[model samples]
Target: MNDAPLLEVRHLTRHFDDVAAVEDVSFQIKPGEIWGFIGPNGAGKTTTMRICATLDLPTKGDVLVNGISVLANPDNARGKIGFMPDALGTYADTTIEEYLDFFARACGLRGDMLAKRIQSVAEFTELGHLMGRMMDSLSKGMSQRLCLAKTLLHDPQLLILDEPASGLDPRARVDFRELIRALANQGKAVLISSHILSELSETCDGVIVIEKGRLVREGKVESLASNVSKNELLNLRCLAKTSDVEIALAEHPGVLKVRESEGSFVIEFDGDEKDIADLLKTLVNKNLSPVEFHWHRIDLEELFLSFTEGTLS
Candidate 1:
């Protein structure tokens, strides 16, 4: 989509009395990108999100939404962002349609425009069926969908979601992940914070890790995984005996260990791509007749644990 970043945070810092809530944190989110903001409780994830949403001003830094500075032009920056907080304070008596209509009107939409925007977000979020339902009576998943619909009413270019998947069930989490991917595909930049590292690893293009109100690491999920991973899991399926393959792999230069499970050989390899290629060549020379060989790389959880001490606050 666009070459320029849709959201940019430059050395953002926030302090309350003597406590530094956030310190010199900086990151950028380009259009059609989903960046995961990850950390434990009280790690300043919410504070950073508030700054980007223009709800709270940074003490020392600046945030730009579509090149509009949050410090210099907060109203303009707010217009470019749709912020969904951890707790969506909804009126219990309001129906889904009315809720969306109210937000659309508040965003300066009216008449045909309000109606069209409500209908569009309703259809997109699949909230049309629940239009007549009261907010208090809806399920957790349905309420989250409604909140997302409210966030989309103004058609903002950037979405800052704080713990969006927090109380969602397994099925609801999957559906929400798909919905987020769809939004990014439509050229919207999404910066989402969540404690679910495994899910974020699957959906986000990259992640930023913060601890003790300071940035610790920020990069693509895959690249970080590769860099921090010390070993690789490779599964091999061969026509020969499993024990024979295991012994052969154990003696290889790059292989750390080998085990047999079911009808395949599981190998722990400590090597790079070229090493893997050489391994395959060695296997071919040994006439192992491998039917399947696949490498299972490290995941986000491992990468995150490598950097953090695994403690909240």
Candidate 2:
């Protein structure tokens, strides 16, 4: 990836009359990186994405796609960015191949170039076999892949995906993640917005979280996890019941929070090298030694929930 930013949104604000849809959001996306633009519904994610995609004019502030100003030259900006909205439409009579061909022609591809682009995108999205399939006949997952294929027809440098995996199953979601990683590896700067924290952690390089129409946090996933839960607790499986284990660790100073999980107990603490040993010694004294113990890492869902203070829709 180059040192220069592929896309930059500076003080981008959008408002509907007196209501601020997006409030002075600023972020930079580097080449070959998948940046997760995340937030709950009505958090201004779609509004912000539309501005970046040149589909909506910002009430204030500016956006630059590959250094081209979106406001000053929207046509140029459109050429550099591909937008996949949450809802997509497909013509009932058109086949998958015909749909891609239509978009390619609209994007000004000609002759062999159009054919190659259509074929390439079809192959990339695993839609080669569905080329002749009518749009209405395709399943939800297949249609979503077709939507992505259509988005790639123009071969834009930056892609803005808004909840692209909404209706996809687990297997289809995995395929979608691989598709996104492939795009990033091919040096495309992608901005994906999704409420699914697990999906974002699996695909994105960094995350930008918005809340109440404002950017609340932005950084590496590991940074968020480390900041929220440091020296995470170990899940201890005790032979005793939950009530007995809770009583045994109640007075232990090394333990911070104790909660029951399934049939086991989860003990959290700021355990130093000696604190871990002390915790085990304390447990042994009560004749309630744990049969299994495993360290836990805080996931993106936990980190996001901790910071956002609510469910992401």
Candidate 3:
């Protein structure tokens, strides 16, 4: 991956009248990295993204796409970005194919070029069969797929998606995640915002979190979890007696504390994955039979609650 970011938001601050909708937010998206932008309803996620897309101006700072300032050269920057809003923005009487073709034309494609882009995005989004279908008739999941197809029509390097998986079913959300993964693997920089943290945790390489209008946290999911967590726990279930298990774990340097819970030993571990693995190895070396041993890491949902106060901006 390139050391330089394909999309960079530098000290961005946006004001609606006297109220700061987004305040001094900064982050960078390297090529091929899929990042999640998260916060409460009034946390200024949309405000920040709109400025990044060049649809809104910041009161202070700026957004850069491929090193072009979004504030100074919005048209040039826009060509390098694909921005998808929370709403589908479907037309009243447009078919899926019609919408794509129209946008392709607007993007300066003519004849074969227009036809090819329309076909390519449609196929990638799995909207080929539904090309003739009306946009208004799509399900929430299908509408999001169509919106994604539209966004990809320009083959932009950076993607800004807001709440794309909001109302999707389990299967649709999974499909959406796979699509995002595919995009990132193909070297697109993606910045997505959503309230569904579990899914975000599964899909994103890392996340940038904000509270109200200011940045609160930013990093990989596991890294952020470590920062917010007091300590990590290892849940070990054994066929052996709890006393035997505790005795076996006592010799390991990584085991901080061990308490019996039901049929398992909830061990407070003071190390990383390698240390955890070594602990398990040591227990087996002590001739203690083990059935289950795994770390209980903090997930994104818990991390989000820990990071932000659910207040509107």
Candidate 4:
């Protein structure tokens, strides 16, 4: 993978009149990587994206695409990036082919070259079959696919997608994930903002979380997960009665709580990993015969809760 970022946001800030919509946000996205941009409602994700896309200018900061300043050269920036807004308007009378052709021409493509580009994008998005279908009659999934196809018409190096999978069903969501992976495989840098944490965790290489117009965290998902506090987590299954494990752990010095299920025991400790390890070793020495013992890795939901100050829902 390329080490240099294809896109960079440096202390980007945007204000509307007297209100700040984005504040000192910064992140970088390298080629062939999918970066997830997530935040609570009204967290300024769209505002920041708009600035990066050159649709709006930042009040205090700047954006760079392929090492060129977007503020200095917006037309050049537009050529290198594609911005897919959350809500797109579809022309009811236009067919899919016509719609893509129109956008291609608007982007300054023409003649045989424009037709070829349109056809290629349609085939790539699996919309070749739907080329003759009316844009207004397509399903949500089909429409989203068409929108993505349109975005690819110019073969932009960086794609900024705002909730591209918003109204998709489970199957459609999975297909969209596959499409993102395909784009990254083709060396395109993608910045996607979505509320689907699990889906984003599964597909994106890194995540940037924003809150109230400021950046909160930006890193690989695994690294961000590792930063979360994982205190009081225990996973233990016993060879003996589960009650035995629960009781033993509950009576331990640093143990805060012990819960027993059908065949397992969860012991919440009030100490560090070293303490937990010592406790486990003590249990083994005492012959309580625990079958499973491991620290519980926090899931994406828990990580999100721990990191964000506001509600993500």
For candidate 4, write residues 1-313 as lDDT tens digits.
6779999999998888987879899899999999999888888999988889999888898999999899999999899998899987958799988899889999999999998999898888899888899888999999899889988999999999999999999999999999989999999999999866776888899999888888888899888765654456787887876666666776789987665678876565779778988998888876888788887766666567767743211
Could you give me the TM-score of model 1 versus the true structure?
0.81
The reply for model 4, stretches above 4 Å from the true place, is 230-232, 235-251, 256-294, 309-313
Ranking, TM-score, top scorer first: 2, 4, 1, 3
Q: Tens digit of lDDT per residue, candidate 3, span 162-247?
A: 99999999999999999999999999999999877888998999999888799999998878877764566777887777788877
Write the residue-wise lDDT of candidate 1 on 1-313 in tens digits. Answer: 6689999999999998898999999999999999999998999999999989988888899998999999999988888899999987959788887888888989999899999999999999898888998888988898898889999999999999999998999999999999999999999999999877998988999999998899988999877766664587787888877777777787899887676669877677878889999998888888888889998655677567768963211
Relative to the true structure, candidate 1 has a C-alpha RMSD (angstroms) of 5.2
Candidate 2 local distance difference test against the native: 0.86
Output the better candidate (1/3) by lDDT: 1
Of candidates 2 and 1, the better by lDDT: 1
For all predictions, the C-alpha RMSD in Å is 5.2, 2.6, 5.5, 4.4
Clashes within 3 Å, all models in order: 0, 0, 0, 0
Best by lDDT: 1
Cα lDDT of model 2 by residue, 75-189, tens digit: 9889888899997795989988888888999999999999999999999998998799989998889988888998999898999999999989999999999999999889999
TM-score of each: 0.81, 0.92, 0.81, 0.84
**lDDT of residue 216 for candidate 3:** 92
Tell me the spans in candidate 2 whose CA falls farther than 4 Å from its real position. Answer: 237-241, 259-266, 310-313
